[model samples]
Target: MITFPKDFLWGAATSAPQTEGAALLDGKSPSTWDKWFEMEPELFFDGVGPNDTSNVYVQYKEDIALMKKMSMNSYRTSIAWTRLLPDGKTLNPKAVAFYRDYFEEMIKQGIEPIINLFHFDMPWWLMEKGGWEARESVDHFAFYAKTAFEQFGDIVKKWATFNEPLVHIECGYMGDAHYPKVHDFKRAIQVGYHTLLAHAAAVKAYKESSQNDGEIGIILNLSPVYAKSEEPADQEARHKADLIYIRSFVDTVVHGYFPQEFIDLLEENQLLPETQAGDRTIFEENTVDFLGVNYYQPLRVQAVENPRFPAQSPGDFARYYDWPEKRINPHRGWEIYPEGMYDIAMRLKKDYYNIPWYVSENGMGVEGEEQFLDAQGVIQDDYRIAFLEDHLAMLAKAMQEGSQCFGYHMWTFVDCWSWLNAYKNRYGFYRLNREQNYARSDKASSYWMKQVIEQSGFEYGGHL
Candidate 1:
């Protein structure tokens, strides 16, 4: 029987906009997501936008009972910026009370609460005023962080400043996939840099707060990049891809500064972000106490003859992006390589002082086309179980190799609305029926995860 250490944390993760339903209640203003769903509903897949997803804002009591049923000892959830502080400047007492009560309930049920400050839910007011690209938004974010620390820090000790800041840069700024869609490489770099500065300012604010043992950090979705071949061009392509995609955020957050290679690349392309004089010192001195690593899939890179520039470019010889040929899961259309987890852990250990870290979010998403009718009308999700098993085995191997990895939390607890995909790719142990007032039913993976949590490890051929 494979066993994990007794102190290992077993939990599930959920974000506010994805799960919570009360988007316009209790003086809570609309966030960018709420505004996007209202203005451009057609942009979302399946014609479903974040109206009242899973109704977790109201059904959190029942959700906590579900967590208890799953034998979960830990849970990760993000604070809705607009929910806590409308207009990103003023705090809502009712919102603070609701979260405090919810957290108290979780503690009463013997579950540890891991609170993340921002999960891509920027307030509409802030977005209207230029979002992260503007310096005022950074100051507003620092104010929100300070307010959160003062109000919720008494009970919530584990604080995460931002969740997957690189995703915001890549998808929202560089690519047009996410909301506030802008396709400018320079703006993406500037937004990414400003995000790090905000994170550092928040960390510094948390350090100065009255909470003595409060731990603060940032969450990064660290996907290890691999070259397709041993050719010089392929290797160089991989390096460039890593610098742009992964190292830009990782090096800055962990080492408190951007890599010189990345700066040189930005300079060569004339895509360098605007930076103030004291910004470097803010990042360097205010590094996080821990890191939350979200591993989903590895990026496979190959040398490209001509890289497509999302922004206006001045070069003809600039290389483009290409993916390495790899096996992808039929259900999710993502590469299923478990060794990427090991590579990520090892890279963190070798390069980032081996700081205390945890697998904040990792899971599989499957389009459940064939819905099975179990006794309670549950869908059997054996594919998700298999995905978690493979990845967790890699995590166990990394732990054995002396990586300072702490715990693992799946991507979500219940199937909720994804940003643009809506509910197309379901990544949850429990399934939610959006039509029936967001009714929830536990899938087979829910029971499987319960057993895994109870045993603290996986055993082959043991009733999954």
Candidate 2:
């Protein structure tokens, strides 16, 4: 049987706005998501928005108890900036008390809490100040990060500065799916640069502050790209995709600088982000202690003759050709490529000096998951169980070959609101009943996960 290291951490991840429903309660202010919903409620699935979410603010205690029951040794969650600093400056005492008590309870139950500072929920006021595109916003985020560390650093030692930084740059700035939807290449570059700088600044503050015992890192959603064929053009397409999506963030955060190739390409296109003095030193000195990888699928790419200016946000610099023959997650319209997980780990080993990392967010979201409930009232999520097993086996193979990955946290804990998609798809091991006051019930996958945690691993089987 395959097994993991003795200290392997098994847990689930959850973000604040997706789970905590007290949008306007307890002196909390509006997040960018709240404001977005107000502007375009119809954009969200079934008109459900950020205001409608699982009541984690009130039920965190019960949730912590449920985590223990699930045999989880760790948990990943984000603190809402709007909740802590209503205006992104003034500290809300009530927010502080709630967070301290919530974190304390998680620690008391023998669960390690890994906290993330930002998860796409910028304070509405910050967005009003041009968000990450403005230079001043970087300092504001750094201040928020320092405040969080100063307040809750004792219990939460594993801190992620931001979750999926590239996602924000792609969706919010390039694609029209997220808030502040602006399809501008120059703006995307600016926002992305500032986000990376903000991350570096947070790392610097963490080091300069009294909270020096903990590690700070960032989470990135990485999809390994493969050339559709051995053609030279296809290979070039794959490289361009990697440059924009993966290496752009990985190279800077881990190596403390942007890749020369990326810089050259930006210069050629006149799309370089505006930089300031000493920004280079901040990045060079504040490289992350660890990295978080969120992989769900591999990107299959082929070259195109004429790439468009506004290339669907991320694909702007490269052309994309689909793999029609690949196995598919019919429920979610994503490719099911378990080997991508192993490929990512191997890349980290060879290219990034094997810095310690973990699968921070990886799971399959199924549409209308409640329909899978059986006569006994249990959701038979055999598909999800199989999906995890396939991916975990790949991760296990990488670890045996010496990848420095220490933990594996699923995408989420409870079924909660997904941005734009809302509650249309559920990724949680524990299903939520929206009609019944957001009551949660464990699915078969939850019990299966408990077994995996208890055994520390499982026998390898062919991908489902």
Best by TM-score: 2
Note the clash tally of each candidate.
Answer: 3, 0
lDDT of 1 by residue, 275-382 (tens): 789988898988888899998888766777775553242122124334545657788888777788889888888888888899999988888633654777878877
Instruction: Give lDDT tens digits, candidate 2, residues 1-464.
Output: 76888689999998999999889899899988998899988888999888889889999999999999988999999999999989878999999999999999989998999999999998888888899998999999999999999999887899999999888887988778887998988899999999999999999999998977989899999899999899888888888889988998999999999999988878877788899899999999999999989988887888777766534344655566678778888789888898999999999999999999999989998998878899988999999988999999989999999999999999889998999998888899898888998888989999988988888888766664
Which runs in model 2 stand beyond 4 Å of their true positions?
308-316
**What clash count does candidate 1 reach?**
3
Residue 345 alpha-carbon offset, candidate 2, angstroms? 0.3
Q: After superposition, how far is residue 23 of candidate 2 from its true place, in Å?
A: 0.9
Please provide TM-scores, in order, for all candidate models, with all chains considered together. 0.95, 0.98
Q: Which candidate is the best by lDDT?
A: 2
Among all windows of ten consecutive residues in candidate 1, which has the lowest summed lDDT? 311-320
**Quality of model 2 by C-alpha lDDT:** 0.89
Name the runs in model 1 displaced over 4 angstroms: 307-325, 461-464
